[model samples]
Target: MATPGVFLISAFVFAFAAANIGGALSYTRPPPRQTLSVPLADDLDSNSPQQVHVSLVGEDKMRISWITEDRAPAIVEYGTSPGVYGSSAMGNTSSYKFITYKSGKIHDVVIGPLNPNTVYYYRCSLDSSRAFSFKTPPAQLPIKFAITADLGQSGWTNSTLQHIAASNYDVLLLPGDLSYADLLQPQWDSFGRLLEPLASQRPWMVTQGNHEIEKIPVIHPHAFTSYNARWHMPFEESVSDSNLYYSFDVASVHVVMLGSYTDFDPQSAQYAWLQADLGKVNRSRTPWLVVLIHAPWYNSNTAHQGEAESDNMRKLHGRVDL
Candidate 1:
């Protein structure tokens, strides 16, 4: 009973819709890419420094961190020229145990009052003949920062590291999920050695992710055991007692690294610290404020949707002026 023109238009629309539905039903997801694990360096001597990396401390200080099989002095000798040591700073050493795995001696030394935008040559300890060097970030604006997240130990990580190394960035800001050790302590060492080439040359400021929570209930009874022992941030300077959350200033920017896996309720310490930290920020001096968190506050992806961390953080951000 329909008119010929109307019938023809309806048929066309039906066919088009059917074709699109069929295509959608037949769509196949591509296979995931294969990623290889980065092996640990076996060439270095037992006492030789390995996994050497640097991180920013206060305004004019750098924290040199490294691991050695045998106990070594937590000392760093640095100067402008190679092999010409002028000043030295000593720090502390500590290690951790994870189930059956025990970590090597980890040394952390805070060397400082360094000149900005200048390269400084340094060595870990007096016993080592090998030397390494790093360039301090620029003191003022136009400072370049490389932001990375969820960097696991894999072939993809290597490729990413190579790209970051070529970027010549002044500082590196890692949101979280470093190493992806996931309770495997040795993977942390492998990750350190893997990133040392780039991390040593520049400052890598990082925070904790879900993967860093290596707590195993009563068996382990502790969270971030390995992380706390290794990647020590300048939380004390920010008046934060825990290393999980902290803030630092570089150039004209102030960066706040928040811990998404930790407690962030209204009555939590992290929440209180965040409120105080933001209150103390002087926007006049620091024109730019950058905040980093592992769990995204806004994500369209179906995965990790409606997670408590993301939900609470999003709500919290709405309350804050930032």
Candidate 2:
């Protein structure tokens, strides 16, 4: 025989406790696995294609790049649908030489005249392993892109990938310092595999960073040998002599990716090209001009304090805009 007020209070307390417990049980959890459908290291050690990625070559053309344990022809069979690849294209492959290890075969093929803003499916091999799909950028305004730099292999990198995948961005612009492969070559392969799920699904346009300049002493002191071998950009199409710098346009946005590690003085080739590229930009077509470089011209970081690229660029009519 409890009082009416006591009975009501007791019921209310019970309901509150039950609701909190239910809420706790319903909390969302991240997946136990690292990345979706990521193959084991053993699978990547052979001729199997690893670190497969895509890049936009033109309005109607796309390039697919991958690495293999051995030299193989760059073959890509693509069409508007999966398993129905009525078209096939073959390209070339190249390898990079290090002091100890010779890198696997790097393959690249530019396939073209694809339907705008449509989801296209393709297989990399003549004996295709897994079919991948990518959507061409729409020929209209409001293009969405995700840009980041210095993405070394770590747990944070894993989380970043998961977030990027969920966002469904149209393009990925990595200014520089990708993989942090530095001297250790195996990390490059690992980085590629980790990025496959996201990069394979979108265009990952990149430029060289200081880290990419892995200059080995004694045997091979040359720079960018490994970086140049792995990442093949469409600089040639843009009439640029070096892949170290290039520009591309998507919708109303024109992106200029510069090489901080390369020459940027007034008399340098890059500076001259930059001037010509800027002069040719039609504001009517591309209203927004965006520039990306690994080292910020106006950065306050003490690590790169001695660098005066920002000041030098300004003197040469290269203004930094946020």
C-alpha RMSD of each candidate structure in angstroms: 13.2, 16.3
What is candidate 2's CA lDDT for residue 10? 8
Per-model CA lDDT versus the true structure: 0.81, 0.76
TM-score of 2: 0.80
TM-score of each: 0.84, 0.80
Write one digit per residue (lDDT tens) for candidate 1, span 1-322.
1111100000001111221222223323334445445555556788888888899998899999999888888899989998899999999999888989999999999998988899999999665566899999888878888887878876678778888988989999888888888987878987888788888889999998888999998889899999999999999999997999999988877888988888999999999999999899877677677888887664454553334344344445666697
Number of backbone clashes in candidate 2: 0
Error of 1 at 84 (Å): 0.7
Q: Give per-candidate clash totals.
A: 0, 0
* Range of the 10 consecutive residues with the lowest summed lDDT in candidate 1: 6-15
Top TM-score prediction, candidate number? 1
